[model samples]
Target: MNTDPRPSEHASPCDAAADWFVRLHSGTVSKADLRLFEQWRQADPEHDRQYRNVCRISGAAQHLSAQALRAILKQDAHPATPQQHRRLSRRAFGLGLVGACSSVLVMGVLHRQGLFDEPLETYHLQTRRGEHQELALPDGSILRANTDTLAIARLYEGRRTVELRRGEVFFSVARSTRSPFIIDAGSTEITVTGTRFNVSRTDSAVQVAVESGSVEVSGGRWWNRRTRRLAAGQAVTAYHDAAPEGIRTVDVTNIAAWQRGDIIFDDTPLALALEELNRYLPHPVHLDDTALRSHRISGIVRSGKPEAMLEMLPDFAPVSVHRQADGQIRILPR
Candidate 1:
C-alpha cells in the first residue's frame, strides 16, 4: 500500500479476507475470530465482496483432487510469508481449506502465468496513437487495445499468455477449466480464468482494474513476492519492480471508458490530466505555470475529439488554454 512491495505493506483487504476465510473453514474457528471478522467486514464494504469471492471460488474447487492442489502450490512460484506458507501448505496438501484463490484453483486445470509445455504460436496486437482496435482470439476471448498500445499473444493447446509491451488492454476472457489466461505487464503477472478486466501499462507503472469477476495481481521480489485478489469494482496500481499498492474502490463502469470513445476524469490534477490527454492529442499539451499543476480537473472529453479536452480546461481550472500556430496546446495561469 505504501509502495514498499512487502507483503506486510501491500496486502489488501482481499488478502486479509482470504486468511480469515481459511481460518474459519479450517475446522479451527472460534467465537472471537468470528467477531473480529465481522468487524473487518463492516469496516469496509469492499471486504464483503472480497470474502464472497473467496468463498465462491473455494466452493467451485471443492471437488479438485489432492494431487491437483499440490501441483498448484509447486508451480505458482510465489513466495509466501511464514503465515501464508503455513496456510498454503494446509490448503494445498490438506485439501480441506484453500486460501487466496481465483477460479483456477484446480492445479491440473491451471497454468501459472501461462507458462506452458507445448510449443506455442505467437501474434501481436497493437494500436497507434489515438487508434482503437478490438480483436477476438482463437480461444474465444475478446481483447481491446487502446491508443499507442502493444501486446503480444502466444497461443498453446491448453493455455494462453499475453505480454503487455506498452499501453493499455481490456480483456473479456473465455472461461476454461484446464486453461488460464495470463498477462505479463512489466514486472507484474496477472492470472485469470474467466473475467473482464482492464490493464494499462505506462512508462513507469501498470494499473489493473476489474470490471467483472476477479484477477490476482502478483509482483515484488521473486524470493518474497506478494499477490492480491481484486474483485469487481476494485483497482490496483504498481510501479515497476514493486508489488501492487493497496487496492482501491472504483466505478467499474468507468473502467477503460476510452473503449467507448470517452475519457472521464474525476477531480484529477491538472498536470496529470494533461498527461493522459497527450496520449490522444496530435500535439502535446504543456502547462506554462508549474504552480498550476495543483489545479483539479473533472470532465468528460470524447476520445475522437481530443481537442475538446483543451476547450473545457478554462471552465474548471483557473487557467487559460491556447493553441499555437504549430498546433501544440499550452496552459497558463489566469
Candidate 2:
C-alpha cells in the first residue's frame, strides 16, 4: 500500500491541497483534521504531487511573517471571509511565489538604472537602526560614521576622496601633509591636510563641523567658487545649488558623539534623531509627519537600545512607535 498521494482524476485536488498546505502549517489545524488531510492527499499519487507543488510555492516566502502576509492580502481589497483567507494563506507562505515577487521588485530597480546597462560593483556603507561605526581608512585617517550613515570612497590620483552620499561622518586626519584628504558632500568639497572634523550631508544642506585642526570648505556655482576656513569647534553649512553659508562655533564633542556609539539630541528634531539612530542597527526607522518630526527632542541614546530609544521618543513627541517583523521601526503621529 503506497502512502504516496496521487491527484484525483475525478476532481482537481491542487487548489484544495494549496489551501490545506497553508492551514496545516498555521498551527490551527487539529490532529484529526491533519489525519483527514493526509488521508485525502494519499488517496492518489497525483493528489500528492499537486499538494507538494502548492506547498513549494509558498515555502519560499517563509521569511515574511504572518502580519506582512495579512497586510499584502488586505491590499488586494478582496472581501475574503475567514475560511477563504485560510485558503489563500498557502499561496502567501509559499517560498517560490514569494521569491518570484522579490524578483519583480529587483527587476523594477534594475530597469530604472538604465535601458541596457547596470552599475558595476555598487558600494554601500550604512549604519544599522541603532548602531554606529568608526571606520579607519588605509591612509591612517578615521571616519566616525553616524547612525544611518553611508559614505562611498572613490580613489583617484594622489588624493584620497570620499563622497558623503547620506548621513554624517567625523574624519580624523593622519599626518601625511603630502596626500590631501577631500570629502565631497553634495555641492560642497571639504579639503583637509592634517585635521579632524565632522561632515554631514542632509537634503537641505551640507554641514561641516570641525574638531581638531582646520579644513577649507568650497562650494558655489560651477564657475564661481567660494571658500571658507573652519577652525576647531567651528561649523558651516552649504545650501543646495547655492553659495557657502557663514561658519559658526559649536561643541566638537557633542557633534562627534556618534563615533562613540552614542547620539546626543539637544532639542533636535525628531526626524533628524531617527535619521541618526538608523545608522548602527540592521533595522530601519521611519518618521511619519513633518510637524511631529519637527518637534524638539533632547536625550542621550546609547548603542544597542533600539527599543529603548523608541520608547523614550513618545515622551518628547506625540507619536506612536511600532515594531515590524523585519526589525524596522515605524513612527506615526498619535
Candidate 3:
C-alpha cells in the first residue's frame, strides 16, 4: 500500500534493505508503509537475512559511540534455559498483577528431592508514569522497561519467559544453546535464542521489533493463531484476530528513543501523534475541535513535555494551544 518506489528485481538485497531502512528511519512509519515492507521481506528469505545484516552494521556503527549504546550493546553482542519438575503456575500470581503497581518478589515454592536442576527466578518489573527502569537478568541479559510497564520474567532450567501484562519492554537476551527466551504479551508470544528486540503491548494489539538476531512472533484472537518470523531490523504488529501478515523493515535505532526521553513524529496525523504522546503524559491532551484531528504535524519533542509539544501546533496547523485551570491541555482552531 505504500507509494514509495521500491528496488528493481535485480537490485541486491542490501540495496533493498538499505532503502527500507531509510524510509522507516525517516521519522514517520505508517501501517501501509510497514505492510508493504512486510510483503517485500516475506517474498524471500534472503531479503530478511540481508536486512538483518544492514541493521547490525548500522546500529553498531552509529550507536556505538554513545554511552547509553555502549551499556546496552557491550553485553548485547556477547549474548539462555531451563526445565523444572514440570509443576508451576507458569503465570503471574498476585492480586496486584492487574493493579497499577506490583512488587518484585520470589515465590517460596519448595523443590522436591533437593534436585538442583534449577529454581525458577521470577521478577515483577514495572515503572510509573514518565518513569523508566533497567534491570539485569541472571543470565546476563538486560531488560529496559518503558513508562508504566508491567511484566513478569520467569526463568526455568531450559526456558526463559517474560509475561508482558502491559506496556513495552526491550530485551537483550543472552545467547543460549539449549534454552530459548519466550515473551508472552496479551495474545502474542515471541520466542528467541539470543536477540535484542522490543515488544509493546496494548489491550488490542502487540508489536514486535528485532534489533539484532531474529525472533518468532505468534499470536492472534481466540479465532485465529498466527506466527511470523522477524529478522533484525524487521517489525510486525499482530492484532487480536488478524492472521500473521508479514515482517516490516523498521528503524532499529529510533525504536528505543524513549530511552533518550524523546519522541519523533513525521507528518503524522494530529490524532495519532497525540495518542502516542499521551502515553507519557500524566494528564491527557484534548483537541477543542474534532475536525483538527486530521491535521498532520511533524517535530521532535521531549517525552511528556506538554509545552514543547503543544507550542508547535500553530506552526504546522491553524491551531492554538490552551491550558485549563484543571491542569488540562487543549488545542483550539485558530
Candidate 4:
C-alpha cells in the first residue's frame, strides 16, 4: 500500500472531468452525453471545479472574433474536426480527445475572457517571441509590446480594458474620464486615468515604473501588508511570498528611453540588470562568474548590439563577456 497522505487515485476524476469539459466546449458532445456530463459534474465538488477550469479556458477561445481566430489558425495548422466525423486514429491521437481539444490557443482564449462576464468589448495587441511591435488603440492610447508579449484590450460602453498575461508592455494613455482603464497583470491591478507607464510581470513579481501621471496599484498585500501608489518618476515592485517593497524616485526619461532603443541602468546590480538586458537579444545572456554577480552597473546600452554590451561590461567590472558558437553570451571573471 502507498504511504503517502495524498489520495493517489484522486487525479483521475479531475482528469476525466477536464476531458468532458473540452468536448462540451468544442460543441462535439451529443445531448445524451451532455446529460451524462451534468450528472458527473453534480456528483462531486472536485468535478465541478475541474469542469469550471476547462470552461473558463474554452470561453476565452469563443471570445475571439471570427477574423482573429482565422488569422491565428492560419499561422499554425490547427486540428479541425472532419465534416463526416470519423473515429479518432489510434496511432497519432494517443491521448485520445484530451490532447486534441485542450490546445494552448483555446485555453489562452478562455483565460483572457473568463475574468468577467457580460461581453465587455476590449481592444488587444500582442507579439511573439523574438519580436516587438507597437500599435495605437481605438481610445488613442499607445501600446508597446515587448518581445513575447500578448495583450487583450477593448474600449467599450463606459470602460477601457487591457490584459497583459505575460512579458512587458508600455502604455501611453489618451486620458478619458468616461472610461477609466484597468490593466490586469498577474495578481496586480493597475488603474489608470490618462497616464504613461510601463508594467512588467514575471513568475516572481510585478514591477511598475511610472513615466508620466500617477497610477494606483492594489492587492499586492501580504498578510497584514498595505498597498502602495506610484507617482511619476517613481517605481515600485511587488513580489509573491513577500510584502511589496522598494519605492524609489528615479529619472523617468532614462527609464523610458528603452522605448527609443536605448537601455539604461543606474547602479543596478549586474544580476538584475542582466535579466532586463537579456530581453532585447536573440540569444540569452548568462553569468558564469559567481563573484561578479553583485557588481553594480550604471551606463547606457544600445538595444541592437549584443556584442557591444559585452565589450562595455569590462570597464565597470573585472569580467569578460564571451559569445559561444551557439550564440549564448557567457560572462567570466577576468
Candidate number of the best lDDT:
1
TM-score of each: 0.58, 0.50, 0.56, 0.58
* Top of the candidates by TM-score: 4
lDDT of 1 by residue, 46-68 (tens): 87887875675453232233344
Model 1, position 179, has a per-residue lDDT of 83
Query: Taking the tens digit of each residue's C-alpha lDDT, what string does model 2 give over 140-187?
Result: 777777666789864444456677888887788886676677787766
Cα error, candidate 3, residue 164 (Å): 1.5
lDDT of 3 by residue, 79-189 (tens): 111233222223222321221111110111112211122437888899987889988999988999988799988898877878898888899999997988888775577
In candidate 4 the C-alpha lDDT for residue 135 amounts to 78
TM for candidate 4 is 0.58
**Runs in model 4 lying further than 4 Å from the true structure:** 1-114, 128-132, 146-148, 155-158, 201-205, 219-226, 240-242, 288-294, 332-334
Q: What does candidate 4's lDDT look like per residue over 116-234, in tens digits? A: 33335655677765577897986688999877677888665666777778778899988987778788775566788899999876555667889998887754322223457889999
lDDT of each: 0.72, 0.64, 0.67, 0.65
Q: Which order, best to worst by TM-score?
A: 4, 1, 3, 2
Better of 1 and 4 by TM-score: 4
Between prediction 3 and prediction 4, the one with superior lDDT is 3
Clashing pairs for predicted structure model 3, backbone only: 79-175, 81-157, 81-158, 82-156, 82-157, 82-158, 82-159, 83-157, 83-158, 221-240
Once fitted onto the true fold, the runs of candidate 2 whose alpha carbons sit more than 4 angstroms away are 1-140, 144-158, 175-179, 201-206, 219-228, 237-246, 322-328
Name the lDDT of candidate 4. 0.65
| Model 1, C-alpha of 295: deviation from truth (Å) | 6.4
Residue pairs with backbone overlap in model 1? none
